[model samples]
Target: MARRVPRPAGAGAWGRSMGQGLLRKSKIGDNKSTQVDLWGGACMVRQVENVLLVLEYFAERRAPATVAEMTDHFGWPRSSAFNIVSTLAERGYLYEPRARGAYYPTPRWLTMAQAVSEADPVPAALTRVLDRLVDETGETAWIARASGLHVVMLDVRESPQMLRYVARPGMRLPIHVTGSGQALMARMATAEREALLKRIRYQAYNRNSPMEAETVRQQIADSEERGWFMSNSAFSSDLAGVALPIRIDGHAYAVTTAGPENRFVPRMPEIAAAIRGAVAAECGAGALDMTPLRAEA
Candidate 1:
Protein backbone atom coordinates (compact mmCIF):
# COMPACT_ATOMS: atom_id res chain seq x y z
CA MET A 1 0.00 0.00 0.00
CA ALA A 2 1.12 3.56 -0.66
CA ARG A 3 1.74 5.81 2.35
CA ARG A 4 -0.33 8.95 3.08
CA VAL A 5 0.84 12.21 4.56
CA PRO A 6 -0.42 13.24 7.97
CA ARG A 7 -2.72 16.22 8.44
CA PRO A 8 -1.13 19.50 9.48
CA ALA A 9 -1.23 20.49 13.15
CA GLY A 10 -3.86 23.21 12.84
CA ALA A 11 -6.27 21.16 10.77
CA GLY A 12 -8.76 19.44 13.08
CA ALA A 13 -7.98 15.73 13.50
CA TRP A 14 -11.64 14.82 13.07
CA GLY A 15 -11.85 16.75 9.81
CA ARG A 16 -8.77 14.96 8.51
CA SER A 17 -9.97 11.43 9.17
CA MET A 18 -9.85 10.06 5.61
CA GLY A 19 -6.80 12.13 4.60
CA GLN A 20 -4.84 11.25 7.75
CA GLY A 21 -5.58 7.53 7.48
CA LEU A 22 -4.29 7.60 3.91
CA LEU A 23 -1.17 9.37 5.17
CA ARG A 24 -0.64 6.71 7.83
CA LYS A 25 -0.87 4.09 5.11
CA SER A 26 1.35 6.24 2.80
CA LYS A 27 -1.14 6.74 -0.06
CA ILE A 28 -3.47 9.38 -1.48
CA GLY A 29 -6.61 8.01 -3.03
CA ASP A 30 -9.69 9.00 -4.99
CA ASN A 31 -12.41 6.46 -4.18
CA LYS A 32 -10.62 3.11 -3.81
CA SER A 33 -7.03 3.37 -2.61
CA THR A 34 -4.59 2.31 -5.31
CA GLN A 35 -1.36 1.10 -3.75
CA VAL A 36 1.27 3.05 -5.69
CA ASP A 37 4.02 2.34 -3.20
CA LEU A 38 4.33 -1.45 -3.37
CA TRP A 39 7.81 -1.86 -1.89
CA GLY A 40 6.19 -2.79 1.46
CA GLY A 41 8.68 -0.43 3.08
CA ALA A 42 7.69 1.92 5.87
CA CYS A 43 7.61 5.51 4.63
CA MET A 44 7.61 8.58 6.86
CA VAL A 45 4.13 10.13 6.96
CA ARG A 46 5.48 13.55 7.97
CA GLN A 47 7.85 13.51 5.01
CA VAL A 48 4.94 12.76 2.69
CA GLU A 49 2.90 15.56 4.24
CA ASN A 50 5.74 18.03 3.78
CA VAL A 51 6.12 17.06 0.15
CA LEU A 52 2.36 17.33 -0.40
CA LEU A 53 2.37 20.76 1.23
CA VAL A 54 5.10 21.90 -1.12
CA LEU A 55 3.21 20.43 -4.08
CA GLU A 56 -0.01 22.18 -3.02
CA TYR A 57 1.79 25.48 -2.62
CA PHE A 58 3.04 25.11 -6.17
CA ALA A 59 -0.28 23.78 -7.47
CA GLU A 60 -2.03 26.91 -6.20
CA ARG A 61 0.17 29.32 -8.11
CA ARG A 62 2.92 27.46 -10.09
CA ALA A 63 6.00 28.82 -8.33
CA PRO A 64 8.96 26.52 -7.83
CA ALA A 65 10.03 26.08 -4.18
CA THR A 66 13.57 25.21 -3.06
CA VAL A 67 14.70 22.29 -0.86
CA ALA A 68 15.55 24.73 1.93
CA GLU A 69 11.96 26.00 1.88
CA MET A 70 10.62 22.43 2.13
CA THR A 71 13.07 21.35 4.84
CA ASP A 72 12.31 24.48 6.89
CA HIS A 73 8.62 23.77 6.54
CA PHE A 74 8.85 20.08 7.62
CA GLY A 75 12.06 19.84 9.70
CA TRP A 76 12.84 16.47 8.13
CA PRO A 77 16.27 15.01 7.46
CA ARG A 78 17.68 16.31 4.17
CA SER A 79 18.12 12.82 2.72
CA SER A 80 14.51 11.77 3.54
CA ALA A 81 13.17 15.05 2.24
CA PHE A 82 15.01 14.74 -1.07
CA ASN A 83 14.02 11.06 -1.42
CA ILE A 84 10.32 11.72 -0.93
CA VAL A 85 10.34 14.45 -3.54
CA SER A 86 12.47 12.32 -5.85
CA THR A 87 9.93 9.50 -5.56
CA LEU A 88 7.09 11.86 -6.42
CA ALA A 89 9.01 13.20 -9.41
CA GLU A 90 9.67 9.69 -10.65
CA ARG A 91 5.97 8.89 -10.35
CA GLY A 92 5.18 11.93 -12.53
CA TYR A 93 3.49 13.75 -9.66
CA LEU A 94 6.13 16.49 -9.70
CA TYR A 95 9.12 17.79 -11.60
CA GLU A 96 12.42 19.05 -10.14
CA PRO A 97 15.63 20.33 -11.61
CA ARG A 98 18.50 17.86 -11.24
CA ALA A 99 20.91 20.65 -10.16
CA ARG A 100 18.73 23.29 -8.46
CA GLY A 101 16.27 20.80 -6.81
CA ALA A 102 13.46 23.35 -7.20
CA TYR A 103 10.11 21.61 -7.75
CA TYR A 104 6.67 22.05 -9.34
CA PRO A 105 3.74 19.77 -10.07
CA THR A 106 3.85 18.14 -13.50
CA PRO A 107 1.04 18.16 -16.07
CA ARG A 108 0.78 14.40 -15.56
CA TRP A 109 -0.10 14.89 -11.90
CA LEU A 110 -2.78 17.47 -12.72
CA THR A 111 -4.23 15.23 -15.39
CA MET A 112 -4.32 12.19 -13.13
CA ALA A 113 -5.65 14.16 -10.19
CA GLN A 114 -8.37 15.72 -12.36
CA ALA A 115 -9.38 12.27 -13.54
CA VAL A 116 -9.57 11.08 -9.95
CA SER A 117 -11.53 14.10 -8.76
CA GLU A 118 -14.01 13.84 -11.66
CA ALA A 119 -14.61 10.20 -10.78
CA ASP A 120 -14.93 11.01 -7.07
CA PRO A 121 -18.29 11.45 -5.37
CA VAL A 122 -18.89 15.17 -5.90
CA PRO A 123 -18.73 15.13 -9.68
CA ALA A 124 -19.99 11.55 -9.68
CA ALA A 125 -23.12 12.66 -7.89
CA LEU A 126 -23.59 15.37 -10.49
CA THR A 127 -23.04 12.82 -13.24
CA ARG A 128 -25.56 10.43 -11.72
CA VAL A 129 -28.11 13.22 -11.63
CA LEU A 130 -27.37 14.10 -15.24
CA ASP A 131 -27.67 10.46 -16.22
CA ARG A 132 -31.04 10.22 -14.54
CA LEU A 133 -32.10 13.31 -16.48
CA VAL A 134 -31.19 11.65 -19.75
CA ASP A 135 -33.12 8.53 -18.73
CA GLU A 136 -36.12 10.54 -17.64
CA THR A 137 -36.46 12.73 -20.70
CA GLY A 138 -34.35 11.05 -23.41
CA GLU A 139 -32.40 14.26 -23.94
CA THR A 140 -28.81 15.42 -23.66
CA ALA A 141 -27.68 16.60 -20.20
CA TRP A 142 -25.05 19.16 -19.26
CA ILE A 143 -23.36 20.55 -16.14
CA ALA A 144 -21.52 23.78 -16.78
CA ARG A 145 -19.74 26.44 -14.77
CA ALA A 146 -18.73 30.00 -15.44
CA SER A 147 -15.10 30.51 -16.48
CA GLY A 148 -14.01 34.04 -17.21
CA LEU A 149 -16.44 35.67 -19.70
CA HIS A 150 -17.53 32.24 -20.90
CA VAL A 151 -19.14 29.02 -19.69
CA VAL A 152 -17.10 25.86 -19.45
CA MET A 153 -18.93 22.64 -20.20
CA LEU A 154 -17.73 20.42 -17.38
CA ASP A 155 -19.59 17.19 -18.04
CA VAL A 156 -22.28 15.94 -20.38
CA ARG A 157 -24.22 12.83 -21.23
CA GLU A 158 -25.49 12.71 -24.81
CA SER A 159 -28.86 11.55 -26.03
CA PRO A 160 -28.99 8.23 -27.90
CA GLN A 161 -30.37 9.92 -31.02
CA MET A 162 -28.34 10.11 -34.21
CA LEU A 163 -28.00 13.90 -33.94
CA ARG A 164 -27.21 14.85 -30.32
CA TYR A 165 -25.19 17.49 -28.50
CA VAL A 166 -21.52 16.60 -28.94
CA ALA A 167 -19.49 18.76 -26.60
CA ARG A 168 -16.42 17.63 -24.69
CA PRO A 169 -14.41 18.73 -21.67
CA GLY A 170 -12.64 22.09 -21.85
CA MET A 171 -15.26 23.35 -24.27
CA ARG A 172 -15.91 27.06 -23.64
CA LEU A 173 -18.67 29.13 -25.23
CA PRO A 174 -19.48 32.83 -24.94
CA ILE A 175 -21.80 33.68 -22.01
CA HIS A 176 -24.19 35.66 -24.21
CA VAL A 177 -24.87 32.70 -26.51
CA THR A 178 -25.45 30.08 -23.89
CA GLY A 179 -28.45 29.48 -21.59
CA SER A 180 -26.15 28.02 -18.95
CA GLY A 181 -24.05 31.17 -19.01
CA GLN A 182 -27.09 33.49 -18.94
CA ALA A 183 -28.49 31.68 -15.88
CA LEU A 184 -25.22 32.30 -14.04
CA MET A 185 -25.22 35.93 -15.22
CA ALA A 186 -28.77 36.41 -13.94
CA ARG A 187 -27.55 35.89 -10.38
CA MET A 188 -24.30 37.90 -10.58
CA ALA A 189 -23.95 41.49 -9.40
CA THR A 190 -24.24 44.28 -12.00
CA ALA A 191 -20.58 45.28 -11.72
CA GLU A 192 -19.40 41.70 -12.14
CA ARG A 193 -21.76 41.17 -15.05
CA GLU A 194 -20.58 44.33 -16.76
CA ALA A 195 -16.95 43.51 -16.10
CA LEU A 196 -17.38 40.12 -17.68
CA LEU A 197 -19.11 41.65 -20.69
CA LYS A 198 -16.35 44.21 -21.08
CA ARG A 199 -13.69 41.52 -20.94
CA ILE A 200 -15.28 39.44 -23.69
CA ARG A 201 -15.46 40.90 -27.20
CA TYR A 202 -18.84 40.90 -28.91
CA GLN A 203 -17.41 39.68 -32.20
CA ALA A 204 -19.86 38.01 -34.54
CA TYR A 205 -18.53 34.53 -35.16
CA ASN A 206 -21.52 33.49 -37.32
CA ARG A 207 -24.17 35.36 -39.27
CA ASN A 208 -27.25 34.36 -37.27
CA SER A 209 -25.47 34.58 -33.89
CA PRO A 210 -25.11 38.31 -33.45
CA MET A 211 -24.84 39.29 -29.78
CA GLU A 212 -23.94 42.89 -28.93
CA ALA A 213 -23.15 44.06 -25.36
CA GLU A 214 -26.59 45.67 -25.01
CA THR A 215 -28.29 42.51 -26.26
CA VAL A 216 -26.38 40.45 -23.72
CA ARG A 217 -27.45 42.79 -20.90
CA GLN A 218 -31.06 42.55 -21.99
CA GLN A 219 -30.83 38.73 -22.04
CA ILE A 220 -29.50 38.67 -18.48
CA ALA A 221 -32.43 40.89 -17.39
CA ASP A 222 -34.85 38.57 -19.08
CA SER A 223 -33.33 35.52 -17.40
CA GLU A 224 -33.69 37.13 -13.97
CA GLU A 225 -37.33 37.98 -14.77
CA ARG A 226 -38.20 34.47 -15.99
CA GLY A 227 -36.28 32.66 -13.20
CA TRP A 228 -34.43 30.70 -15.93
CA PHE A 229 -32.48 31.18 -19.16
CA MET A 230 -33.70 29.79 -22.47
CA SER A 231 -32.13 29.99 -25.89
CA ASN A 232 -33.27 28.70 -29.26
CA SER A 233 -30.29 28.53 -31.64
CA ALA A 234 -28.61 31.10 -29.34
CA PHE A 235 -25.44 29.02 -29.40
CA SER A 236 -25.53 26.62 -32.32
CA SER A 237 -27.78 27.30 -35.30
CA ASP A 238 -30.12 24.37 -34.65
CA LEU A 239 -29.45 23.54 -30.99
CA ALA A 240 -31.08 25.03 -27.90
CA GLY A 241 -30.12 24.79 -24.20
CA VAL A 242 -32.02 25.69 -21.00
CA ALA A 243 -30.09 26.44 -17.84
CA LEU A 244 -30.41 27.30 -14.13
CA PRO A 245 -27.70 28.42 -11.75
CA ILE A 246 -26.30 26.09 -9.08
CA ARG A 247 -26.00 28.16 -5.93
CA ILE A 248 -24.15 27.18 -2.79
CA ASP A 249 -24.20 29.71 0.04
CA GLY A 250 -25.81 32.32 -2.19
CA HIS A 251 -23.00 31.98 -4.71
CA ALA A 252 -23.40 30.58 -8.19
CA TYR A 253 -20.75 28.04 -9.16
CA ALA A 254 -22.40 26.44 -12.17
CA VAL A 255 -25.58 25.40 -13.96
CA THR A 256 -27.14 22.04 -14.81
CA THR A 257 -29.35 21.29 -17.81
CA ALA A 258 -31.09 19.12 -20.40
CA GLY A 259 -30.30 20.55 -23.78
CA PRO A 260 -29.47 20.29 -27.51
CA GLU A 261 -31.81 22.49 -29.58
CA ASN A 262 -33.89 19.57 -30.73
CA ARG A 263 -35.18 18.85 -27.23
CA PHE A 264 -34.56 22.02 -25.19
CA VAL A 265 -37.47 24.24 -26.29
CA PRO A 266 -40.37 21.85 -25.85
CA ARG A 267 -38.99 20.51 -22.58
CA MET A 268 -37.82 23.79 -21.01
CA PRO A 269 -40.07 23.76 -17.93
CA GLU A 270 -39.43 20.10 -17.10
CA ILE A 271 -35.68 20.39 -17.60
CA ALA A 272 -35.53 23.57 -15.54
CA ALA A 273 -37.36 21.92 -12.65
CA ALA A 274 -35.11 18.85 -12.86
CA ILE A 275 -32.05 21.06 -12.65
CA ARG A 276 -33.47 23.03 -9.71
CA GLY A 277 -34.46 19.87 -7.85
CA ALA A 278 -31.04 18.28 -8.43
CA VAL A 279 -29.12 21.33 -7.22
CA ALA A 280 -31.29 21.68 -4.13
CA ALA A 281 -30.93 17.99 -3.25
CA GLU A 282 -27.22 17.74 -4.00
CA CYS A 283 -26.04 21.00 -2.43
CA GLY A 284 -28.71 21.50 0.27
CA ALA A 285 -28.57 24.84 2.10
CA GLY A 286 -25.02 24.72 3.41
CA ALA A 287 -22.54 27.60 3.47
CA LEU A 288 -19.61 25.21 3.11
CA ASP A 289 -20.95 22.99 0.36
CA MET A 290 -18.71 22.28 -2.67
CA THR A 291 -15.03 23.21 -2.98
CA PRO A 292 -14.17 26.76 -1.98
CA LEU A 293 -13.36 29.21 -4.78
CA ARG A 294 -12.83 32.95 -5.09
CA ALA A 295 -14.87 33.22 -8.34
CA GLU A 296 -17.85 31.09 -7.20
CA ALA A 297 -20.31 33.86 -8.00
Candidate 2:
Protein backbone atom coordinates (compact mmCIF):
# COMPACT_ATOMS: atom_id res chain seq x y z
CA MET A 1 0.00 0.00 0.00
CA ALA A 2 1.22 3.52 -0.79
CA ARG A 3 1.59 5.91 2.07
CA ARG A 4 -1.09 8.68 2.23
CA VAL A 5 0.13 12.25 1.74
CA PRO A 6 -1.37 15.27 3.50
CA ARG A 7 -3.42 17.63 1.33
CA PRO A 8 -1.96 20.99 0.50
CA ALA A 9 -3.35 23.92 2.49
CA GLY A 10 -5.90 26.19 0.60
CA ALA A 11 -6.95 23.37 -1.76
CA GLY A 12 -10.42 24.16 -3.23
CA ALA A 13 -13.02 22.21 -1.17
CA TRP A 14 -15.39 22.29 -4.23
CA GLY A 15 -12.70 20.44 -6.25
CA ARG A 16 -12.68 17.63 -3.68
CA SER A 17 -16.54 17.30 -3.98
CA MET A 18 -16.28 17.15 -7.80
CA GLY A 19 -13.69 14.32 -7.60
CA GLN A 20 -15.99 12.23 -5.33
CA GLY A 21 -18.98 12.83 -7.65
CA LEU A 22 -17.05 11.63 -10.69
CA LEU A 23 -16.10 8.35 -8.96
CA ARG A 24 -19.75 7.66 -7.96
CA LYS A 25 -21.08 8.39 -11.47
CA SER A 26 -18.56 5.96 -13.04
CA LYS A 27 -19.76 3.13 -10.78
CA ILE A 28 -23.45 3.83 -11.55
CA GLY A 29 -22.83 3.97 -15.31
CA ASP A 30 -21.20 0.54 -15.36
CA ASN A 31 -24.05 -1.02 -13.36
CA LYS A 32 -26.73 0.54 -15.62
CA SER A 33 -25.10 -0.73 -18.85
CA THR A 34 -24.87 -4.26 -17.44
CA GLN A 35 -28.57 -4.22 -16.47
CA VAL A 36 -29.68 -3.01 -19.92
CA ASP A 37 -27.65 -5.73 -21.68
CA LEU A 38 -29.22 -8.41 -19.51
CA TRP A 39 -32.85 -7.30 -20.00
CA GLY A 40 -32.50 -6.45 -23.70
CA GLY A 41 -32.42 -10.21 -24.46
CA ALA A 42 -36.19 -10.29 -23.99
CA CYS A 43 -37.15 -7.66 -26.59
CA MET A 44 -40.89 -7.55 -27.55
CA VAL A 45 -40.30 -8.51 -31.18
CA ARG A 46 -38.31 -11.57 -30.14
CA GLN A 47 -41.01 -12.50 -27.63
CA VAL A 48 -43.72 -12.35 -30.33
CA GLU A 49 -41.60 -14.46 -32.68
CA ASN A 50 -41.18 -17.05 -29.97
CA VAL A 51 -44.95 -17.12 -29.31
CA LEU A 52 -45.65 -17.57 -33.02
CA LEU A 53 -43.19 -20.43 -33.23
CA VAL A 54 -44.87 -22.10 -30.26
CA LEU A 55 -48.32 -21.67 -31.86
CA GLU A 56 -47.14 -23.15 -35.16
CA TYR A 57 -45.76 -26.16 -33.37
CA PHE A 58 -49.06 -26.67 -31.55
CA ALA A 59 -50.98 -26.40 -34.82
CA GLU A 60 -48.80 -28.97 -36.52
CA ARG A 61 -48.91 -31.48 -33.66
CA ARG A 62 -52.55 -30.97 -32.60
CA ALA A 63 -51.60 -31.76 -29.01
CA PRO A 64 -51.86 -30.13 -25.63
CA ALA A 65 -48.83 -28.26 -24.33
CA THR A 66 -48.32 -27.26 -20.72
CA VAL A 67 -46.87 -24.06 -19.29
CA ALA A 68 -43.96 -26.10 -18.05
CA GLU A 69 -43.49 -27.40 -21.56
CA MET A 70 -43.53 -23.87 -22.97
CA THR A 71 -41.13 -22.64 -20.31
CA ASP A 72 -38.69 -25.42 -21.03
CA HIS A 73 -39.03 -25.05 -24.79
CA PHE A 74 -38.75 -21.25 -24.97
CA GLY A 75 -36.44 -20.78 -21.95
CA TRP A 76 -38.87 -18.14 -20.73
CA PRO A 77 -39.89 -17.42 -17.16
CA ARG A 78 -42.92 -19.25 -15.80
CA SER A 79 -44.99 -16.06 -15.71
CA SER A 80 -44.43 -15.36 -19.40
CA ALA A 81 -45.45 -18.90 -20.34
CA PHE A 82 -48.66 -18.65 -18.32
CA ASN A 83 -49.56 -15.28 -19.83
CA ILE A 84 -49.12 -16.48 -23.41
CA VAL A 85 -51.16 -19.62 -22.83
CA SER A 86 -54.02 -17.84 -21.07
CA THR A 87 -54.22 -15.08 -23.69
CA LEU A 88 -54.28 -17.52 -26.59
CA ALA A 89 -56.96 -19.59 -24.89
CA GLU A 90 -59.10 -16.53 -24.19
CA ARG A 91 -58.85 -15.46 -27.83
CA GLY A 92 -60.31 -18.89 -28.87
CA TYR A 93 -57.10 -20.03 -30.49
CA LEU A 94 -56.48 -22.63 -27.81
CA TYR A 95 -58.62 -24.79 -25.57
CA GLU A 96 -57.73 -25.33 -21.94
CA PRO A 97 -59.39 -28.10 -20.02
CA ARG A 98 -60.30 -27.27 -16.42
CA ALA A 99 -57.39 -28.06 -14.08
CA ARG A 100 -55.63 -29.89 -16.94
CA GLY A 101 -52.54 -27.69 -16.99
CA ALA A 102 -52.37 -28.03 -20.78
CA TYR A 103 -53.80 -26.39 -23.90
CA TYR A 104 -54.71 -27.59 -27.39
CA PRO A 105 -55.29 -25.60 -30.54
CA THR A 106 -59.00 -25.14 -31.35
CA PRO A 107 -60.67 -25.56 -34.73
CA ARG A 108 -61.00 -21.80 -34.97
CA TRP A 109 -57.24 -21.43 -34.77
CA LEU A 110 -56.81 -23.93 -37.55
CA THR A 111 -59.39 -22.21 -39.76
CA MET A 112 -57.93 -18.72 -39.39
CA ALA A 113 -54.37 -19.91 -39.69
CA GLN A 114 -55.29 -21.77 -42.85
CA ALA A 115 -57.03 -18.71 -44.27
CA VAL A 116 -54.03 -16.50 -43.56
CA SER A 117 -51.65 -19.15 -44.82
CA GLU A 118 -53.56 -19.43 -48.09
CA ALA A 119 -53.45 -15.64 -48.56
CA ASP A 120 -57.13 -15.54 -49.48
CA PRO A 121 -57.58 -13.01 -52.26
CA VAL A 122 -61.26 -12.38 -51.55
CA PRO A 123 -60.57 -10.55 -48.30
CA ALA A 124 -58.02 -8.26 -49.90
CA ALA A 125 -60.50 -7.27 -52.59
CA LEU A 126 -63.30 -6.86 -50.06
CA THR A 127 -61.15 -4.56 -47.93
CA ARG A 128 -60.69 -2.14 -50.82
CA VAL A 129 -64.44 -2.01 -51.35
CA LEU A 130 -65.15 -1.46 -47.67
CA ASP A 131 -62.73 1.44 -47.64
CA ARG A 132 -64.51 3.08 -50.58
CA LEU A 133 -67.89 2.56 -48.97
CA VAL A 134 -66.78 4.41 -45.88
CA ASP A 135 -65.45 7.22 -48.06
CA GLU A 136 -68.57 7.54 -50.21
CA THR A 137 -71.21 7.14 -47.53
CA GLY A 138 -69.49 9.11 -44.76
CA GLU A 139 -71.12 6.61 -42.41
CA THR A 140 -69.34 3.78 -40.72
CA ALA A 141 -69.03 0.69 -42.93
CA TRP A 142 -68.20 -2.88 -42.07
CA ILE A 143 -67.13 -6.14 -43.71
CA ALA A 144 -68.28 -9.24 -41.92
CA ARG A 145 -66.86 -12.65 -42.78
CA ALA A 146 -68.83 -15.76 -41.98
CA SER A 147 -67.52 -18.19 -39.41
CA GLY A 148 -68.97 -21.43 -38.10
CA LEU A 149 -72.34 -20.66 -36.47
CA HIS A 150 -71.31 -17.02 -36.12
CA VAL A 151 -70.37 -13.96 -38.15
CA VAL A 152 -67.23 -12.09 -37.13
CA MET A 153 -66.80 -8.46 -37.96
CA LEU A 154 -63.55 -8.65 -39.92
CA ASP A 155 -63.06 -4.92 -40.33
CA VAL A 156 -64.85 -1.63 -39.76
CA ARG A 157 -64.27 2.01 -40.74
CA GLU A 158 -65.69 4.70 -38.46
CA SER A 159 -67.72 7.67 -39.62
CA PRO A 160 -66.17 11.05 -38.93
CA GLN A 161 -69.29 11.89 -36.87
CA MET A 162 -68.89 13.02 -33.30
CA LEU A 163 -71.58 10.50 -32.36
CA ARG A 164 -70.89 7.39 -34.41
CA TYR A 165 -71.82 3.68 -34.20
CA VAL A 166 -70.24 1.05 -31.99
CA ALA A 167 -69.14 -1.85 -34.22
CA ARG A 168 -65.59 -2.99 -33.64
CA PRO A 169 -63.15 -5.18 -35.50
CA GLY A 170 -63.06 -8.81 -34.30
CA MET A 171 -66.41 -8.30 -32.55
CA ARG A 172 -68.72 -11.27 -32.98
CA LEU A 173 -72.44 -10.58 -33.49
CA PRO A 174 -75.06 -13.35 -33.45
CA ILE A 175 -76.09 -14.42 -36.97
CA HIS A 176 -79.83 -14.26 -36.23
CA VAL A 177 -80.17 -10.53 -35.42
CA THR A 178 -77.85 -8.32 -37.48
CA GLY A 179 -78.23 -7.20 -41.11
CA SER A 180 -74.81 -8.56 -42.01
CA GLY A 181 -75.85 -11.86 -40.55
CA GLN A 182 -79.11 -12.00 -42.55
CA ALA A 183 -77.36 -11.14 -45.83
CA LEU A 184 -74.86 -13.99 -45.57
CA MET A 185 -77.38 -16.52 -44.22
CA ALA A 186 -79.64 -15.73 -47.17
CA ARG A 187 -76.92 -16.85 -49.56
CA MET A 188 -76.00 -20.08 -47.76
CA ALA A 189 -77.28 -23.37 -49.18
CA THR A 190 -80.62 -24.48 -47.77
CA ALA A 191 -79.18 -27.39 -45.79
CA GLU A 192 -76.44 -25.33 -44.20
CA ARG A 193 -78.85 -22.56 -43.22
CA GLU A 194 -81.15 -24.93 -41.40
CA ALA A 195 -78.29 -26.56 -39.53
CA LEU A 196 -76.97 -23.21 -38.34
CA LEU A 197 -80.37 -21.92 -37.33
CA LYS A 198 -80.87 -24.87 -35.00
CA ARG A 199 -77.87 -23.86 -32.88
CA ILE A 200 -78.71 -20.14 -32.60
CA ARG A 201 -79.94 -18.60 -29.34
CA TYR A 202 -82.31 -15.72 -29.86
CA GLN A 203 -81.91 -12.80 -27.44
CA ALA A 204 -85.09 -10.87 -26.59
CA TYR A 205 -85.50 -8.26 -23.89
CA ASN A 206 -88.54 -6.33 -22.61
CA ARG A 207 -90.41 -4.52 -25.41
CA ASN A 208 -87.86 -5.78 -27.94
CA SER A 209 -89.25 -8.13 -30.57
CA PRO A 210 -87.55 -11.45 -31.17
CA MET A 211 -87.49 -13.27 -34.49
CA GLU A 212 -88.66 -16.85 -34.61
CA ALA A 213 -86.63 -19.32 -36.62
CA GLU A 214 -89.27 -19.24 -39.34
CA THR A 215 -89.34 -15.45 -39.37
CA VAL A 216 -85.55 -15.36 -39.62
CA ARG A 217 -85.76 -17.75 -42.55
CA GLN A 218 -88.36 -15.67 -44.32
CA GLN A 219 -86.42 -12.43 -43.79
CA ILE A 220 -83.33 -14.03 -45.25
CA ALA A 221 -85.32 -15.19 -48.26
CA ASP A 222 -86.69 -11.68 -48.78
CA SER A 223 -83.20 -10.19 -48.49
CA GLU A 224 -81.96 -12.45 -51.27
CA GLU A 225 -84.92 -11.61 -53.51
CA ARG A 226 -84.54 -7.87 -52.97
CA GLY A 227 -80.73 -7.94 -53.35
CA TRP A 228 -80.35 -5.86 -50.18
CA PHE A 229 -81.34 -5.86 -46.53
CA MET A 230 -82.85 -2.81 -44.83
CA SER A 231 -84.18 -2.27 -41.35
CA ASN A 232 -85.46 0.67 -39.34
CA SER A 233 -85.13 0.49 -35.57
CA ALA A 234 -84.14 -3.15 -35.81
CA PHE A 235 -80.92 -3.33 -33.87
CA SER A 236 -81.56 -0.09 -31.99
CA SER A 237 -84.48 2.31 -31.75
CA ASP A 238 -82.71 5.29 -33.35
CA LEU A 239 -80.31 3.52 -35.72
CA ALA A 240 -81.06 2.12 -39.18
CA GLY A 241 -78.90 0.12 -41.61
CA VAL A 242 -78.82 -1.33 -45.13
CA ALA A 243 -76.59 -4.17 -46.25
CA LEU A 244 -75.60 -5.95 -49.47
CA PRO A 245 -73.72 -9.16 -50.02
CA ILE A 246 -70.50 -9.09 -52.00
CA ARG A 247 -70.40 -12.42 -53.87
CA ILE A 248 -66.94 -12.84 -55.29
CA ASP A 249 -65.22 -16.02 -56.42
CA GLY A 250 -68.01 -17.95 -54.63
CA HIS A 251 -67.14 -16.36 -51.28
CA ALA A 252 -69.81 -14.26 -49.54
CA TYR A 253 -68.76 -11.05 -47.79
CA ALA A 254 -71.18 -8.39 -46.48
CA VAL A 255 -71.07 -4.58 -46.42
CA THR A 256 -73.36 -2.59 -44.13
CA THR A 257 -74.04 1.11 -43.45
CA ALA A 258 -75.51 2.37 -40.19
CA GLY A 259 -76.47 5.79 -38.87
CA PRO A 260 -79.31 7.80 -37.30
CA GLU A 261 -82.63 6.31 -38.43
CA ASN A 262 -84.09 9.54 -39.82
CA ARG A 263 -81.12 10.09 -42.11
CA PHE A 264 -80.66 6.43 -42.98
CA VAL A 265 -84.23 5.52 -44.10
CA PRO A 266 -84.88 8.55 -46.30
CA ARG A 267 -81.60 8.01 -48.15
CA MET A 268 -81.72 4.19 -48.03
CA PRO A 269 -81.49 3.92 -51.82
CA GLU A 270 -78.48 6.24 -52.00
CA ILE A 271 -76.70 4.37 -49.21
CA ALA A 272 -77.44 1.03 -50.88
CA ALA A 273 -76.01 2.21 -54.18
CA ALA A 274 -72.81 3.39 -52.50
CA ILE A 275 -72.36 -0.07 -51.00
CA ARG A 276 -73.07 -1.77 -54.36
CA GLY A 277 -70.64 0.48 -56.22
CA ALA A 278 -67.97 -0.31 -53.69
CA VAL A 279 -68.62 -4.03 -54.22
CA ALA A 280 -68.54 -3.71 -58.00
CA ALA A 281 -65.21 -1.88 -57.93
CA GLU A 282 -63.87 -4.71 -55.79
CA CYS A 283 -64.78 -7.19 -58.58
CA GLY A 284 -62.64 -5.14 -61.02
CA ALA A 285 -65.63 -3.80 -62.95
CA GLY A 286 -65.91 -0.39 -64.59
CA ALA A 287 -68.68 0.92 -62.30
CA LEU A 288 -71.95 -0.23 -60.79
CA ASP A 289 -73.86 2.49 -62.72
CA MET A 290 -77.09 0.88 -61.45
CA THR A 291 -79.16 3.28 -59.41
CA PRO A 292 -81.09 1.95 -56.43
CA LEU A 293 -84.04 4.03 -57.66
CA ARG A 294 -84.36 1.65 -60.59
CA ALA A 295 -83.63 -1.45 -58.53
CA GLU A 296 -86.23 -0.53 -55.92
CA ALA A 297 -89.00 -0.48 -58.57
Off by more than 4 A, model 2: 1-122, 205-209, 284-297
Badly placed stretches (over 4 Å) of model 1 are 1-111, 114-124, 206-210, 249-251, 258-262, 285-297
The lDDT, on a scale of 0 to 1, for candidate 1 is 0.58
- Compose the digit string of candidate 2's lDDT tens values, residues 161-232: 644454545555556666777777766667777887887755441122245788788777777677687655
- Candidate 1, residues 1-297, lDDT tens digits: the string is 234333222211122121101121222211233112211233547645466566644543346767666665556677877787788888887777456878877788668767986663235556776777777667666777776767766776666654455544445676666777777776666777778777666654334454677888887677766767777665445666667766553456455554445556787888777766765666553421332234542
lDDT of all predictions, in order shown? 0.58, 0.60
The alpha-carbon lDDT assigned to residue 202 of candidate 1 equals: 60
Itemize residue pairs with steric clashes in candidate 2. Answer: none
Query: What is candidate 1's TM-score against the reference?
Result: 0.54
